[model samples]
Target: MEKLKMHTPDLAEENYKKLAALFPNAVTETIDDDGNVIRAIDKDVLMQEINTKVVDDGQERYQFTWPDKRKAVILANQPIAKTLRFEKEKSVGKDGTPGGIDSQNIYIEGDNLDALKLLQETYLGKVKMIYIDPPYNTGNDFIYEDDFSQSVADYTNNSGQTDEVGNRLVQNSDNNGRFHTDWLNMIYPRIRLAKDLLSNYGMIFISINEIEVTNLVKACDEIFGNDCHVATFVWKNKYGPGAFTRGVASLHEYVVCYAKHYPNSIEAELSEEEQKKYCKRDNKFEKRVAI
Candidate 1:
């Protein structure tokens, strides 16, 4: 049996049209709630009861029933994996072909989403570590146009395209309406797929500044699970001089680590050499062994 399949959900266009006809004014609106304008839903009784039967449409479809409050069919498919082929040119460095550490590592320069999807076949549940430094959707920052269909060459050559042009270091300010939505959409599926790529002992590290730290934690909690949380480390990235005017001088960043499974041991004892280096004085008897 095939282990993975690509899923493409179809929208019920015909059914939606029929439903729209029943309630011509089934439009979303905002109403005054106290002093604030809040979104309000208005629907017709007849439109709510209307149901459509599946016709002989060549498109793929699946039936999903909504909650008891309302009955609706959601057309969706099971996600599958497709094989991808590519040619790689062998490189000869100064010391001949780079081997050992460098040769084993694969550098795939393309859309990470598709790259990760293709990697699902061979690298599924095999990756030991995953570190991603994604874009910060602050209005001043340049947004990544995550187009899965584009080839590496097409993406690299298209200078005028938004996907290519906007993938740079810029400020993502608050004016953009889809700031949070765009960031979530870009990272959600990638993280979901990453979870499948982790081994039982594997781990993931996410580096983010204060701007998105909270959001990143929330996302990781949902993906890696609240129980798999390992630890959060604060790293001092800068030193001296620079200081924040509004608050305490910002010189550090956060690295959130999560495990794929519950660890039998929470901590590891330092090796003999590590103990000597840290303790300065050689204390052979004080050397501890792994539990």
Candidate 2:
């Protein structure tokens, strides 16, 4: 019998191997910061292998980008040194006993990015669905500024930015410069990591306010691919328009949904009653519903 692996797959290394296999001519050597020789893919050679004409940065193309976008991509592929341990004292058993390990539920308490990274080891391409109500950057919501290079101790002990557990939180005020840029940087890597965890049939629903809905959609389009977008459902939280801000009264938020793979899967199955109603067959098919 073979021993099971205990850690998540190194995504960067895996990607490099795949590229090297496809284009052996692109394989090259490079020196790291530690002066160690390492295998690296030559970008120029790789581009030549895939395309007849190189689309350089100067070329005009449709894209959604912000400052540090490359850094966000790097962050998603970077490996972490963190590990998760079961805390009996903090966990509740299935039978409502303390320190019992009978429960199948797991509640992780840590930085969201780190927690997501740890979950990749066991949950990659396994999760059926994911729903998240992340902080909407409305000038008051707390957003994590992920930076693994710095230690918790290195962060300033400002109560406003540093939470009790040393997670760096930034208040994305509308008045600040790079208001949208900051939020994009924060969410881009999270969605990238989340894509790995979702199975082919999995769907992710994100609850976001109007403040950042557009950017969120564009970000998801890049991560999950534009075709994978399922739908954006408007949720009316209030019966009527309550307080007026500026000149408008916000009455609802939005639930943006995306599928891991579209055309092959639907968000849900129709009810039995609804399914039976679609018995009307079209000339081209056996089962068809009215458009």
Candidate 3:
């Protein structure tokens, strides 16, 4: 009897097929994790194709490419050895009823990547909204580890000092050679994972700043598709530092929203005060009225 293949669809595999269709020479045979022969892409050929200018128009069109991009995609798809454990004692509830401020909500404390992976079995395609305030890649903000294969002690000493609870996060400044690459690798996998969690009608919102807004949008365009991009809202960031931008004070942060599947119509929910004003018309005009 043959064994079962029960897992999420390999996006990279599908991408390989598509690439093969366009440029058959780019397809190659490779050994996978299980030592079985599998389809893979010839990266050199693919790069050649990417750099190729169109014959019809003498113009070049290429995507935002960076170091560790391929690794980031692989990381999102790779299975984690970690599992989530429930703390029954620490859980918020009445004795056994699973009660709290809201019974349906669960608060998992762990690395965000680990948490996203663990939730896949239960919450895949079930989530309606995903809002993430990722590290902004500012001078003082946290940047993720480049090589997890390195020793923890070496990483701790080199990257950053231990915080109160002892979680280490390196400060990512523009001065570092891998400043953008480090931050990109950190958030890329998480964004791909987030896209998987969204329902067909769901949406994902990302909070970003001047430092990394363009990169974040480019990543999302690849992950969620350009057609799914909704909007970007400029919000006044409350009392943030102005040292980064030099003389001109920085006041706003961007909230970028993208839909899994675009809806035909969107309706905004009204507050109590707003709802109260939607009564009868007064003199051919809708006027505010207290309920």
Candidate 4:
């Protein structure tokens, strides 16, 4: 039987030399409150004292051994069956059926998060702009109830069919234990996935009120860096409403804009036609002074 012997080598001198070369401008002497040198110590000596040792032996070989290794077991669950299937013949429009609106490019649907996810494969990194008007997190504001554990049939039936009763709207109360937690969980994953679908020069405009502006800003900062913040547009929704006698009127909403990268790269320069439209006089001084 052969026995293994380990040998270690001292690396204090080499470490001291490396530290000295790395910190060329570092001062050696310690100064006092009066700006006087309390004590002088050699940088090389100080570094050597605290330096670690490295071992290198010609016969030494590193080997990792595992005792009582366990294998990972992943259980397969039965896939849920889908109930609804679209028939192409029934989906085709009849001869007398009125055509849909021409200028209606806007699509207003329920569960924007799910809709956005479904669009991921077809529209990833293709959207030039995205604007969302989410419900403000006020005490009485309504939130879309998304099922985390819903089956495919239930989700399809609920989304495809319209009920005469009305749309399902859930009120998010501040008093709820998981009010902020639920909101965060709902928006966090969606925002993370949305980031992947934004083009290099794409922009996202989010309309928010005073209630969750801070939280929204923080979340945006996390998704898009603090440097990517373009500007916060203040849109006046109400003009002259003085219902309260105590304070100033809160009649403005905020639209936060975040760019994919540096604003200079994404920002477009004024076109020749746009500049001509604003031209009031012939001289450069007149045009500059007009605004």
**Candidate No. with top lDDT:** 2
lDDT at 50, model 1: 51
Residue 40 in candidate 4, Cα distance off native in Å: 50
lDDT of 2 by residue, 1-291 (tens): 987555656778878888778999998999999999988778888777878666678899889999888988888888877788878898888899988888999888778888888899889999988999988999988788765566665654443487677678878889979899989989998998898899988889999999999999999999999999999999998875555656677889999999899855353567999879965657887653331
- Give me the runs in candidate 4 sitting further than 4 Å from their true place: 1-97, 100-108, 147-168, 265-277, 280-291
RMSD of each: 13.8, 4.2, 6.9, 19.6
Question: Of the candidates numbered 3 and 4, which has the greater TM-score value?
Answer: 3
What would you estimate as the lDDT of candidate 3? 0.79
Show where candidate 1 strays beyond 4 Å: 1-86, 90-102, 146-172, 241-247, 266-272, 280-291
Give the TM-score of each candidate.
0.58, 0.83, 0.72, 0.54
Clashing pairs in 3: none
- What lDDT does each candidate get? 0.60, 0.84, 0.79, 0.58
Per the 3 Å backbone cut-off, how many clashing residue pairs does candidate 4 have? 0
Tens digits of per-residue lDDT for model 3 on 97-214?
Answer: 5333335568777677767877777788999999999888887787556466768798887766654545556777779898889899999999988888899999999999999999
Question: Which digits, one per residue and each the tens of the lDDT, describe model 1 over residues 67-117?
Answer: 220111121112334444443454334455533233444666555665666
Candidates sorted on lDDT, descending: 2, 3, 1, 4
Predicted model with the maximum TM-score: 2
Q: TM-score of model 2 relative to the true fold?
A: 0.83
* Predicted candidate 4 versus true structure: per-residue lDDT over 1-291, tens digit per residue: 755222211223334456667664442768788999753435555465658443344556552212211110000011122222333333323343334333324343445554555555557788778777777777766665544366646754665533233344456789977566555555554565566578988888889988778777787787788888887888998878676635777889999888777455443457999878865666645433310
